[model samples]
Target: MRLAILAAYAAVISTATASYAQQSADPSGVWLRDDGNARVRIAPCGSNICATNLWIRDTSKGEEAGDRLVMSLEPKSPDTLAGTAYDAKRDRTYSITVQVSDRSLLTRGCILGGVLCRNVHWQLAR
Candidate 1:
């Protein structure tokens, strides 16, 4: 009775987990910021996706642009991801949602308990 129920629950849980893993999207590419200030390379790290700064347009900013901007994203769908975006310039972390498109990635980062947010459309870099 109890054992059989537990086994059935475990089977269902594992099946769901496997299905989720298979549906995750790979947004791995070199993407350019909308303002053209920097470029970020997103790639798979372990079981999650991570983004790192690849290049910066200006060197006079005196900020470390070559750091990780986003890491350990949760896959919402085959075209969307949810994670935290770290702004090195402001030294803040905001909740972000990334939507991948054919030629662009739309990232929306929110702050102040989601009261303020900024959306950046990142085009794929050649």
Candidate 2:
């Protein structure tokens, strides 16, 4: 009976450790733009995932308020994140694809009806 209990405990511990490792492998953190224009903080929202705007370089010119732009990101892979950005000002959706490179994040997508798309390369902020 004691040996059986030990085995059960070991199994539980192993499962818990594996779960923790999987969560840690996900790139869920604050990601900043290399041009110092934007930063996004990603975290889990219920069963889905959400990202919030953490910062922006300028607020005076051509800056849409990012506070209402919280988006849900679907995990395409262990290192890839895909989501749609809802622009509060324009009431439009933009495709967002982010690739994790070490500690940095490479994001590319478009607004303006997808006709004109631009790649925004972002780095991990210290």
Candidate 3:
């Protein structure tokens, strides 16, 4: 019957959605900032992942040696994660996209519905 077919299709869609939600891209490592001024450790932090600052060469702009951005990310692709990042020190949150690679990461964060955005590049620490 037509209704039965539609129901089956809906169930399949639901299952796929759930599966996608659980899948995540891996962005875990020690990374050096693009400017060579900072390094961060990205690893599992509770149920989400976090990028915590390990060191900062220039820490004048309210950036400390231990500030961290806790991220809640879901896989946007095999090598991309998209979600939100919470900066506890600043008490702000940004929508973020992280492109992951074997040796690099390009992270973009936006606020005010993309009115303000910043992209940070990171390389695996040697």
TM-score of every candidate: 0.77, 0.61, 0.83
Which one is best on lDDT? 3
Off by over 4 Å in 2: 1-25, 62-68
Clashing pairs in 1: none
Which tens-of-lDDT digit does each residue in 1-126 have in candidate 2?
Answer: 999999999999999877655654355687876777778776766664555677777877655435545455666666777777665665767787777777876766777667878787766667
CA shift of 121, model 1, Å: 0.9
Which one wins by lDDT: 2 or 3? 3
Ranking by lDDT: 3, 1, 2
Q: CA lDDT of 72 in candidate 2?
A: 52
Tens-place lDDT per residue, model 1, 3-118, is: 99999999999999889868766678999989888888998767656677788887677644567764557789878888876655568888988898888999888889899999
The TM-score that candidate 2 achieves is 0.61
Model 3 lDDT at residue 26: 84
For model 2, give the RMSD to the true fold: 6.6
- Candidate 3 overall lDDT versus native: 0.92
